[model samples]
Target: MNGILFEKMRFTCQQSGHCCCDPNIIVTLTYRDLLRLFTTLYCDFRLLLQKISFYTLDSTTSPILEKQMVLETILTSDGKVIPGLKKHSKKICVFYSRPSCSIYSSRPLACRNYPLAFVKEKELIMSTWVKNSPKTCPGIGKGSPLSQKNIEQRGKRFFKEIEKHNQVVRELNVEASNNRPLTAREALWTLIIYGESEYQQRQK
Candidate 1:
């Protein structure tokens, strides 16, 4: 019975609208993400290079500042904290139109491996990302089929990559504290230049 049930559990993405509408969708980008974004937007990387802002977790009601942080953390009077980051709307992802992901080539890894989550313990861990109300993604139960084995394998790889990405952030924090302010780009560089397992593996 277990074997029969396992065999029945396979997924093939139909590119329904559900992925875009997922409320839990979080968009965290690294340096590579920015480069891809620039390329996708048809803008020169140098154009964005000159203007980079450091995001600090603070309140600034000041109207005088020309530049405002897109991402911020807010603390309520009750001491509850919230990230001021804006979630990517299903209507907004360049690839999210009617049928499928438009920018599949440049889409972030997080998007590529949806419905799967990774947790960092002593090592990378994989788990299911089930949604109670998958409003937009109608393809969940109807689409092409993917095997459980493939999903598990991909999840493991994804988490390892993410862990490396996190390490870069940790290293950047220390470096920024010792030196000057780091921009979004520089922070991204920390991830790619340092976190690439290929490079790290070569060193050992």
Candidate 2:
């Protein structure tokens, strides 16, 4: 590990509003989420999850609806009724009301873990959030240090949830198209798993 990596990871945020404009955010949801979101739309949970269209729940359509994330979006029209990523706006986070999350209570799992994100891979990769070149976030490095144990605990839960979510996605993708299914590695991490080294080195 680099000696500098253990320097307490200091950052001071000015919150000049730059973090709100990132264009490449991906939001991933679970099969359970698909149901949860549909309930929000249809106002009913007893209906089958497939009752909603997969396209509308996609990242492109619902970018800012919940949290800012990067994940595959379904290619259907009626999928929009589900609680998927809110479409990105010229605005920062759709929930960013001047300075805080508007949907704080129902905010997506990603929002609760801001400034920290997991990368998908054979082994999990963790990455620190770097809000572009000109943005500043007050919580970037000012909170109490999160121990590796703490992060791992969260990671365990996160992975389990994502696994179930991935399973659901695979099923949906298969049902949606008769084409070949995506590899587990590809579907699960979606390329975010390559950052584990950075996460481990910083753990000390």
Candidate 3:
């Protein structure tokens, strides 16, 4: 936990089911997150969760959509879109149980860092609890101050993993554009099964 910040933030989860029950809260899954789920669920992302696609016009892609994120997309009036997750009928997360998260241990990064966000600038990753965390969450400012070092480490690892993930996705996106465009499921399978020599060889 080598960092410049010395102050700690108090937060202890009460498990009141606020975050999990909220319909508006979208849990964005990363490549690693999906891999963890695949391993946990016996390689069944198709059955347990839905594959949401997000499209964006980027320079690296040719007359096509390319983005690392694959949550439900929010299309703007002007045709702009931002991807996010799809909630259940009540806006509850897909994995939310009655009083707790079904996959609490393997929850996505967004769930793990709920009410708090981290941003990376150069080599420094900074964290800040959301202003509304205390309003809706009972855990904030209630327990021992959270170690800033721990938060920094989590943030660092998140960014590091995502960067590696995006690199692989970008390659796939380019390949899809030049050849035949792959379905969302295909793209997701590529991400979930990335790094294997089989996928690489097939791509080549």
Candidate 4:
């Protein structure tokens, strides 16, 4: 119930674009994600910045509010918070284009592993998905079983990149806790441009 539960699973995209336009799913961005997007779009960081917006957790209701990472949170004058991607005014993905994803080639790991989430526990990776997601995803149970080897490879790469990205996020979180919260501009610089050099320096 908490996370996914599967050593291996079956899934295939129906190309319905339901996942891309899912009203409930908010695609969170990572350091690698931003870098890839900037590269793929041949755009500058400032332009990409306009696409991201913050999604804060409700401290009042969230029991583990303090447990949230800095990258997830916005250090507003009010409180710390978790940030996420901004959506179109119609509550759809910014890159969603009616029948397909605008940037499907370089989609984020989260998008890549849709309907097949990996939950790494200690030395294992457990995969899982919504029980009845086929209501919208016609490809579910319609194709041959998904290849475990390939899925593992993708999951491994995703977690590896995630660890590296979270390293920077944790550093920013520390600054927030120490009363040195990064300003909006500084946060954007660190999120979009700087990777781990600043955090690495703090260690030395």
Report the lDDT tens digits of candidate 4 across residue range 1-204.
345433335566778888777777777777767766766767576767676766655647565644533234546433553445567887888888878888899787678877666667796765667444646666666666767677678778877877766777777777777886776556656676664454456699
Q: Give me candidate 1's TM-score against the actual structure.
A: 0.58
Model 1, 1-204: lDDT tens digits are: 111222344455666657655555544454445446556646554543432223333345454331222122212222212211133434344346556666678766667666544443455343544444234455455554556577557767776555555455555556666776455544444444543444558799
- For candidate 2, the per-residue lDDT at 30 reads 54
lDDT of 4 at 81: 39
Q: Candidate 1 local accuracy as lDDT? A: 0.48
Error of 1 at 48 (Å): 7.2
Measured by TM-score, the strongest candidate is 4
TM-score to native of every candidate shown: 0.58, 0.52, 0.73, 0.79
Better of 2 and 4 by TM-score: 4
lDDT of 3 by residue, 1-204 (tens): 323342566778899989877654556666666666666667776653463434344445543333324332222222323333456778776677788887778777677777776666788787776545667888877777778778878888777766766666667656765777565555556667764443468689
Kindly report which residue stretches of model 4 are placed more than 4 angstroms away from their true locations once superposed.
1-8, 64-83, 130-135, 196-204
Model 1 RMSD in angstroms: 8.8
Residue 23 of candidate 3: its Cα lDDT? Answer: 51
User: Of the pair 1 and 4, which is ahead by lDDT?
Assistant: 4
Per-prediction CA RMSD (Å): 8.8, 11.2, 6.8, 4.5
List clashing residue pairs in candidate 3: 9-146, 23-91, 72-84
| Local accuracy by lDDT, each model | 0.48, 0.45, 0.62, 0.66
Candidate 3 residue-wise lDDT at 75:
27
